[model samples]
Target chain A: MPEPKALPFSARDATCPFDPAAELYELQEREGLPRVPVPSPIMGEFEAVELTRYTDAKDAMSDPRLQMGFVFDPEQPRTMMNQPGNLLNYNGADHRRLRRMLTSAFTVKRIRGLLPKIEEIVDSRLDALEAAGPGADIVHEFSTPIPTLVICELLGVPYEDRESFQRRAKIGLDVNTTREEQIANLAEMDAYMGRLVAEHRRSPGDNLLGSVVRDFGDQLTEDELTGIGNMLLVAGHETTASMLSSGVALLLQNPDQLAVVRDDPEAVGDAVEELLRYCSPAIALPREAAEDMVVNGQWIEKGERVVTSLLVANRRIPGAEGDLDVLDVRRTPAPHVTFGYGPHQCLGQQLARAELRVALPALFKRFPTLALGVPEDEVDYRTTALVFAVNKLPVTW
Target chain B: MTLKVEVDEQRCVSAGHCVTSAPDVFDQRDDDGVVHLLDGAPPERRHEQVREAALLCPAAAILLRERDGSA
Candidate 1:
């Protein structure tokens, strides 16, 4: 690499849990796009030009020239990341074909229709939290279960199958798991989904996966259905669970901010957006450049990788109002890259928004005096994982 | 004022941002959730929302052009 910048991509400083490493912001503030060596658990360490500016990150994310699913060889040792139906492993036409089949289930109107069910799920979780009483971990009691239950219902996994689904949900989120362990866990996941998809094929249920099988069965193959089932099940629940947990922690730390979210019904939508921006839960996975491209007047070479730091790029959005360090619950929602941009933008964003919009405010309303069960300093944040999350959030209200 | 609005269904990932931002001007298919432009030339009153929809679109699939430039 020509530049002296080497970055530990997803490491979060305990002292400042909300931000990426300080060097990342500096690279953004510096003049030209810097080709920094970034270490990846999946791809090992490689030189990737950082897209830290808001415009550059947004534009490049959607740019056809910058693609995903090409970085790692799928069959070299096929893992869940690129299994046949996983959206993360496909680009262009192939990506569109797979994604469009699932889009109807996640449309904004579809999510709107789902509000009552989501509310029911949130309320049930709240009841569980109250039953657990004081000294309950929100991760287990509130945040985690809400999304998982909702996703399970959406995917139409039989009640019996969810235990298996939930058990392996965190496998990909652990930073220290060995690659062999990941492959084994993924293999287990593949087989499980395979069986589920097989059942869907025989007699499609009313759930999302069942509906996909019901509606588009002939167009998709067995492996593709299995990949879609697993990816949707995993990505759908895991991302929201982390965001919910982290947003609760962020709000609990800032009582004034939490007050706004709790008291104002109108503020919930905007509050969730701010949470998505301030927390920026998921990191943008690297994309391989198929050809040389210039973003923000800087050129990236063909075959080089590009990493857009969502945490940094989100706060640095040029016209976004208010201070970056402060989490404003009432801030007008900005065009943050939290759900990403372009073709591969998150498929379940509307669904995630609906979950957060309902869950966060409901948690506070139900437990008005919610407080951290452990001391603030004792809270654990899993920064090294693909999704930044609070591992365990013990709460008492 | 006439505000022209168009949606590239091919580029749209059906994030429903346009529908959320400007429901009058944009809608999604019942099947695949692809976007459809409800108003090719939205009236003056709906111009601001139409612009917001275009801005918020994740796919950048919504295209907008202003005609009758004078306000």
Candidate 2:
């Protein structure tokens, strides 16, 4: 196919780092969707028309004609990218079959059950941060470890084996990595998670993987189990970690908002929604148009690829009471597309929400006077990554 | 005012946004976590929450229709 437009868009804004690239918002106001090129090692390269408006983004996503990603091919050897159990890899009936098997484990009620554990995890991380006594990297001390440890406990993956999965998870999400490197990392992850699945088979624990094994072991293939295990590990941790670190960075820059998050017990829930909507950590997967469809009056032909800047959509969301560009924690939450929309919407969303609700407030409450340990511009932000994040967040209380 | 609700169990990926938005009107199936509509035709007071729940549903599983209620 002829290469689409050369209108490649940067994911981040130069001036306001919390927002999507300014061009995306500009594109939202323009006459039509622009064809944007996305190059990735795993899926090679593809050109897609971006849907920037909130209504368009939501409609295009939930529309049945626009599929999640490539359909899972049973003939192909299962890799991290194309596997049986990973819901992101399939569409329609096949997708529902895999997703239903684990839905019980990720329900809002099930996730709420983990609140005590999540609270414990958050407090321990705060203790580590306090002991380090400021000038510490919150990425390391607070953000990264909380979700990592939470997923570990939830999946029954040995926390000691986090080293094996964490590094590869980062490698997998790095868009700059080569195909060979990605393939090698995928294999390593496959084997690592495969062992964890095997371990669960022998004696099922009360965690997610354990519960799946207990209920659906007869139905699930080994590859499916491994895929589900690793998908949760990768999807569950890094996104939340980035959100935590970046949200903290965003909050710290706006002290009044930070105060709202810290002092107000009833407002933290509202605050996390604003943070998710404002920061927009999860970059949505580029979608393939399964059939010709019109999104917000723009005609998209069949076989076309479509993309979305979720950050822009969140900011442009209709019915929001205040300025979209500014951050307001106490404002009523808008229905943002941060967790994405449609059938492939994030499975661990409730768990992620619960984690942030507990973690973010607890971090600030523990250290009443937290401030950036380094110059504002000195903080390294991970912009080009699949998940927008902070490389290291240096802070002092 | 009566708020009538319908849910497509097939479409729900169990994102749980519906339940979060309107817990009294919606719930999740314990077995599959798909949406479980607790109140199909709710009273006037619940109309707003139920509307919010339908809008917030990521899967777009919840659909709402309105009809005048008879006292």
Model 2 per-residue lDDT tens digits across residues A268-300: 998999888888877777778888878877899
Writing each residue's lDDT as its tens digit, candidate 1 over A210-258 gives 8999888999999889889888888888889899998988899999999
> Per-residue lDDT of B22-51 in model 2, one digit per residue for the tens?
888889998999898898987788888888
Q: Would you list the C-alpha lDDT of every candidate in the order shown?
A: 0.83, 0.84
Misplaced by over 4 Å in model 1 are: A1-7, A71-75, B68-71
The CAPRI category of model 2 is: high
Roughly what TM-score does model 2 have, to 2 decimal places? Answer: 0.95
First chain of model 2: TM-score?
Answer: 0.95
